[model samples]
Target: MNQRPDEDFEEDELELYEHHRILVDKGQSPVRIDKFLTEKVANATRNKVQQAIDSGTILVNGQPTKANYKIKASDEIKVLMEKPPRDTEVISENIPLDIVYEDPHLLIVNKPPGMVVHPAHGNWTGTLVNGLVYHFQHLPEMKGNVGRPGLVHRIDKDTSGLLVVAKTEEAMTPLAAQFFHHTIDRTYLALVWGEPEQDSGTIVGHVGRSAKDRKVMDVFPDGSQGKHAVTHWKVVRRLRYVTLVQCNLETGRTHQIRAHMRFLGHPLFNDAMYGGDKIRKGTQFAKYKAFVQNCFDLMPRQALHAMSLGFIHPVTKEKIYFEAPLPEDFSSVLDKWDNYVKHE
Candidate 1:
């Protein structure tokens, strides 16, 4: 079914913004960034470049710089703006989008749970990409199977959080570079089955598809196989049988947090893909079991959300950051736990 153009969308559970970046190549002579941008960027003028610099939207080698600053050869330049990029041929659905920020170059969105980032297999419709294809016109047509047409990165089908979309290649290139270099900052909030003995910790291991089950990933601590992954975590609050923790990713891998948490013996609450659907902690009493079952019924999926993101803007060269709050389902479940703990 098609969505109406005037249809309203749910309020974003979080905040987010867009980015575009660039890098000066070697063998280029020293030139003021304002004047230099005119020669390099399309439709950019000295006045616009100066305005971007003054607004602290441009960065030199990850640090904000002045418009008159001399950009040396090989220096990385980034730009953050609320602009949209060029267009593509994605199938436009009338899906409503929780647009956080947008310009001619890029767009930021707050994605809710139960929605896939891209289309594939049996889950082909009602994806975030379908919504974008509907909301934004003029996406550039490219050859081959363009999975995730304009996405910079992806969150899980059950994970709620922030994401950036590139409308043009100028925006995608630098953001992609930042991700490859492990420069983008991403943080997640997770509710796990047990509290950690330590207040803060780090998990370093390789993550790959499990031999027993190709659908889910497993963590290899011996470094013998899988892709390298690292997650740093700190306790937010302890709720008797469960703990809320914050996680920061050093290297993004499939199911890194869920797998690492399981390896640590604290799998995410109700994470059916792992072994968290059961009551891993708490009492074995019938009443306690009932309470946990209630919680499970309240929240059927893994309790995780992408809460924060930070990166260098591709065109403006300034540092840009985004944050999102918990959605209704997640927040309501937490409230139930909090009330239970206080009553007990």
Candidate 2:
């Protein structure tokens, strides 16, 4: 059986549109276009294909066709859907944004730890995308991707950092391609429980959603499952119980740094999903536990920050780099650790 063409598409990057062009083989049997498309497209159902047909987004020989139309040999079939069907509309909110840089093609914003990058299942309002929509007119939305508009890349909600938004459609493709090719330079600073044995090393493994918990990621050491992920890490500073590590990502999978570090037995401090919320190191005494608890209170989220990002300009081909300083919560936690280490 032929593999679905979209199966080869990268999921980590932004996309402009959902477009599929197929040339019917000479030996292909006569089948309804909706049925054919449902089988040909990944994650496509017959109902969805019918919806596309009804919406006149599916064309045959450059003409919109009905769902029951039978595909013929040597037929040119094209499916062009501007955006996926969204159950909820993204309402523009007049929320403030900390835009670091802006141009005709793109803009860089420093997102705070709690703000959701885009609207999702539970977060439908007050997202960064909602703010972008209100701040900028006509921001481009990713094709087949709903909720996130004008965004080329996103940082996790609890991970404070820089994110690049493509203002124009022309800028989205190249920026997305840079991420897909692993040419974008991204560095994250994380405070992890326990120091790594080595000063610097690379962690290579396949990363995917965990089987036990679908919300979190798990590393596959043998590369039997998930996407290939690589994180080069070096110790920045060593506290008594935790270490500050700088991580450079070679591949940007979901929760790559958090999962990889957890696999290395040093999950990010206060990363609840990866089991870093509790004290992983230090004495088990009541005093030590209270100190750790206080530190967690200072920074309620994961101790991970996207410190820097570098990428080539989509139009000018010039290289650009941006950095975001650690947020107050993360900084306060670090200060507490520093003081504890100094007095100890």
- Backbone clashes in each candidate structure, one number apiece? 38, 0
Q: Write the per-residue lDDT of candidate 1 for residues 188-240, one digit (tens) a residue.
A: 99999988999999999988667555457789989887778889999999998
Which ten residues in a row are the worst by lDDT in model 2? Answer: 7-16
Q: Could you tell me how far off, in angstroms, the CA of residue 81 lies in candidate 2 after the best superposition?
A: 20
For model 2, the superposed segments whose C-alpha errors exceed 4 Å read 1-88
Q: Judged by lDDT, which candidate is best?
A: 2
- lDDT for position 329 in model 2: 94
Best by TM-score: 2
lDDT of 2 by residue, 1-344 (tens): 23221222222222123378999999999999999999999999999989988766777998879988999999999887644434647899999999999999999999898888877645678789899999999888666555667876777778888888999999987887787777899999999999888999999999876645445778998999888999999999999789999999998887889999999999999999889998899997888789899989889999999899899999999999999999999999999999988986
Q: Which ten residues in a row have the lowest lDDT in candidate 1?
A: 5-14
TM-score of model 2 vs. true structure: 0.76
